[model samples]
Target: MKHFHMLLAVLTLIIFVCQALPIWMGKTAKRSAMITGASHLIYTLLMLTGLWLFWQLYQVAGVQHWAIAKLVLLVVAVSATIKALRNQAVQPSQAKAGMMIAAVGYVGILYLAMAKPLLG
Candidate 1:
């Protein structure tokens, strides 16, 4: 489950990059039907697997602070990606900023998941 979750995370990041790069380059990002479909599927799987893993962790350790932080990071990442991808009216600069925010969110989530640091 962990490996699968990791794979989904990577796929989600790749999709975000693919969708964001063209907009960042000042080009209209016209996503193909396949990429769009795959992205939706990947996002759904990622959320389900993530929740399951969180539940498993909670059962073992009783709601770690880092886990809650990770959930917040996940929201940040996904919300930014959606804001950048869905709105055609968004300026290129804004889109770039959104993607950067999402990248940071993803990095933070990954770090928290891997390190499992003790937090207050």
Candidate 2:
């Protein structure tokens, strides 16, 4: 399950980069039905697996601060991605900023999940 979660995290990054590259390069973004569907499926599975992992952690060690941080970062990352990609009215600069935020959120999530730090 942990391995699967890691795989999903990598895939999330790959898909985000692939979709955002054109926009980042100041080119028109293109979307295909297949890529859209795959991304949705991947995100759904990722969230489910993540919840399961969190449940396992809770059972073993009670609540952890890092896990809560991961959850918040996950929401931020996904929300920013959606805002950047789906909002047709967003300016190019705004979209770029949103993508950067999503990237940082994802990185933070990955770090928190891997480190599982004992934060107060």
Candidate 3:
């Protein structure tokens, strides 16, 4: 279970890094965004499976906040990717903002998972 969780985390990190790379390189962001979104979808499924397995094996309630936040961010990521792909002329600022929000949410999710802070 631990190994599975670690692998999921690593994969998610890779997806995030890959998604952000094109922006830093000043290339066509849409292509990379699509790839990143797809990677995120894969990561989400894997993470869900890992969480279910962990719960089944250890009866431990995982970080629900992080999981929920991640799902929300993934939705935003997908939406942004779709919009960018459809309208190549869309302002880069909009895409950048969306990506920034998604990245911030991802970081928040990681913090919540690591700290397990009390959820009011």
Model 3 scores a C-alpha lDDT of 0.60
Highest TM-score model number: 2
Q: Residue by residue across 19-118, what tens digits does model 3's lDDT show?
A: 5556545555455557666676766776677557645644566445545555566566556544543443456665555556656766775675678565
Please report how far candidate 3 places residue 108 from its true position, in Å. 0.7
TM-score of 2: 0.91
Residues forming the 10-long window of minimal summed lDDT in candidate 2: 85-94
Give lDDT tens digits, candidate 1, residues 54-91. Answer: 89988998978998898889889889987877764556
Which ten contiguous residues of candidate 3 have the minimum total lDDT?
Answer: 80-89
| Model 2 CA deviation exceeding 4 Å by range | 88-90
Give the alpha-carbon lDDT of every model: 0.86, 0.85, 0.60
Instruction: Provide the RMSD of all predictions against the true structure, rounded to 1 decimal.
Output: 1.6, 1.5, 4.0
Q: How far is candidate 3 from the true structure (C-alpha RMSD, Å)?
A: 4.0
TM-score for all models, in order of appearance: 0.88, 0.91, 0.63
